[model samples]
Target chain A: MLRRFGLVCVFVSFATLPAHAESVRITQDIEARTITLNGAEIVIDRIQDSENRLEGDFARTSRPCPPFCITPMTVAPGVVTLGELEVMDFLDASVAAGEGLLLDSRLPEFFAKGTIPGAINLPFATLDPANPYRDEILKALGATLTGSDWDFSEARQLAIFCNGPWCDQAPLAIRYLLQSGYPAEKLSYYRGGMQVWLQLGLSTHTPSGG
Target chain B: MSATARVTTTLNAPPDYLGGNMFLASSRRLPEISMLRALAIASLFAGITVALVLFKADPGAPPAAEGANVTRSSAGFDNLAITPTAAVPQVAQSVPQAGPRIQDQGHVASLPAVAADVDLQAMTRGVLAELGVTPPAPPPTDTGADDPLHAMSMAALSGLRKMTGQPDPAQSPSAFQTLIAQALQAGQSDAYIDALLNEAAGSGRITVPSALVTAEGRVDTHVILSTIVAQAAIASGQDIGAAKVSSSGRIQPGQQQVYTVSAGDSLGSIALRFYGDMSRYNTIFDANRTVLSSPDSLRVGQRLVIPTI
Candidate 1:
């Protein structure tokens, strides 16, 4: 009788093995799919629809040049332009790991429409040296104010993005951050922005009641 | 030796099926066969578990890049800079692929079983439904961000804002800016927006954006969302949404609006559509002066920034 029971148990175990290992992850326990701010939770993932395409103003390509010109592959020396997958890795390794921030360098109104998951809108305008609170923003980014000079030793890894490759708001911010002595290695530019992110149907967050 | 002979005798008496020594076959062979079967099952589970662990492993994940020199002494903070750490080779920034080209959503199949959201879980169904994942728990109240200082600064500032009833600012931020400041304090993700748009698109309940076609030649879902929300605001008699959507594509009325030049669109025509007067073509011409030689530089499908008259 015991043998029969053991045989039945073995069969049940064999039948149940289907590889649903949820706890297993490539990175930290955050699992690279979610971000939480204050008390709000933001789940990050690609749009389930493989057929999704870029739409709206981002899709329109005929903006006049000079201001809307295609940005160079690299914004400045030492700074790297990150693609979507690398951005995901950065989010996992740095942002989710709490050593980095995903900054949206566009204006507030554009950010209000919708933005990549886990992004905080810091608007390109504020990164300018002229802004009085710019120092406070830097302090928020992990730059310790030592007397008059800013110390960026422990500054947060900033992965900044704007509308798309055509829009230089992100590049502009990167230049300004460098001018303000933010380390080049600490910043990453997501060149695709809404143009590529939306085209691929990645998840986006819109602030509730905005 | 005698035990071996007895097993041979039992084998030689394989007339068990023929009703000769059936008991012998059951007595000796049963335990060995069952034991081997149990071993095989255990091996199977072990093999599968190892394969799964390897499959989900982040093989592409490189070690976290450390700064080359920890002692970052700028012109200003020469005195207080910390001592330098051992210089490490900084990793070169890798160029990302041009195409995120609609590949299989294979990664979605591996979504951590820990995440909890009834709606998202339902959406995640069918990809790996057979692999029994636990039902998602309730959304977490807190997942402490890794950047303790960033979180702390935000907390401290917002707390102070709450106490003083005003942010200690030389320039007061706009209402939109205030929303942004408050947004960072909370926790969240935006899959809800995508799901909501899908629901709205599926039911034919939402209006489409006036832009005939987007860069991808598909309808703009986000713009559609913006238009709907803006219309809802207008229905409350805000008199908004008439003039311009910024270059980034919010259906807003403000100083800067983007007008896509149609086939017959001269600067004057675009000016007429945006403003009440036709002579205000120069408003657009002047705003885009960096690209336009004269007012005649307009081309079909070119996006012109129409500034307010």
Candidate 2:
């Protein structure tokens, strides 16, 4: 009787196993189309593609050297060097909160193709000392003109980027900003820029949407 | 007795000449004189040939390979007599010409080393001023000229108009309505249109079918904006004592070109059209950071900056 009872128990256990088996889940890959930074959503998609291929200066394998060589790992002494993720975080903390600006330091041509979310187009050439429009750009960045000198007491924090590591535009703008008395500590360098951002499958939006 | 002996000896010597010794001496002396005279004449001819050759070999003379070869071979034979004629032409051509004339030739070669950097602003300013179009004031040294948007504001335009003796004018209801419709069709938010309209109303007043407006009959938000800008330019021009004016400042090449995105337009396609290379899409993207957050997000009719390459 005990043996028979034990066999009956095993049979019951076996019958019950199918119920639990149905409830057990199988792991699957998850692809996210959007990432929320702070309260804002960043769509991760390639900005410009031709026949399913993306285009632009950043698409080039090699750019002319001397002017467009890859920048150093650090831009300046006190400026923070940031990767794509760090840039997104900064975008959330600074741009979303309206505490700082995300500046696209390339020419308007480069900036038009696509850029990080929350970035404003401020061409590097516009801030170049030789450009007649430099002072106007400085004023737009919230610099106060005291005689011929600029005062940056009310300047917002700036996170600047250009084409990518190979682009010198952002570095030029940063150096000019520093020379113009912008606090280096308040500046963040998004060195990866649009190249790295797109490489990692991040979302981008057009200017019209903003 | 010695004198008689000497006279007899002289008479004997004369008879000895009859033995043909005198004839032998004359013959030897005549050959010596003739050989020396021939040598002297040959040296004079050789010197004359050398001087003539040198005079013909002037640098200003046109290149004549055959003539040069002849002169060179002549000199070689006169100096070293062993030089072959066949080698002289090659040697003459191979030798590089050297002289002040050669140096002068280099300077005379075409092409200016340093290009004149033309100041387009100064050039245009002169022409505009001569035409009674007062160019915009030179940028102030003080900070007042620093804010670019300041001069574009409604208050600034009104102030300029007041200074120019232009009274507040009425607007063309039809043109104004057309602007509103176009702005709405362009997908501008109502709030944005309202604000823009209010701003435009406050700035410069213009009427349709007036001589003050540009003849561009297309009534759109662009026309509306341009009308106000024109009014501002005219007012400012009057303030500066100009007889006529259309715009304030010249559009610089460094100023970004605005390209309207069309249907089926991608950054790559737009780049290929504007830059002649699809790969330069990044340039377009980088220029429009203010409007584009993504390369894929280009909208029809969206204005994009096509930056100068």
Instruction: Write model 1 residue lDDT over B137-245, tens digit each, in one string.
Output: 2111122322333333333334323322333331233222222122211111111222332233234443221121122222222222222222222332332322222
How do the candidates score on chain B by TM-score? Answer: 0.20, 0.19
TM-score of 1: 0.36
Query: What lDDT score is found at residue A75 in candidate 1?
Result: 92
Query: All candidates: CA RMSD in angstroms?
Result: 36.4, 37.5
User: TM-score for the second chain in candidate 2?
Assistant: 0.19
Task: Tell me the deviation in Å of residue B23 in model 2.
Answer: 99
Model 1: per-residue Cα lDDT over A1-210, one tens digit each:
999999999988777753333233324454346655434566665554444566678779799997799998899999988998788778667766668888888876787799887777777767667543455567667676543366899888989999998999999999989999999999999999888888766678895544
lDDT of 2 by residue, A1-210 (tens): 999999999999999977655432111232323445445577544323223445565467877797779899899999998886666667667656656677887655555667776676777666656444454455555566543355787767888898788878888889988887788988878888777776654666565523
User: What is the C-alpha lDDT profile of model 2 across B68-115, one tens digit per residue?
Assistant: 222122221121111112222221121111011111111112211111
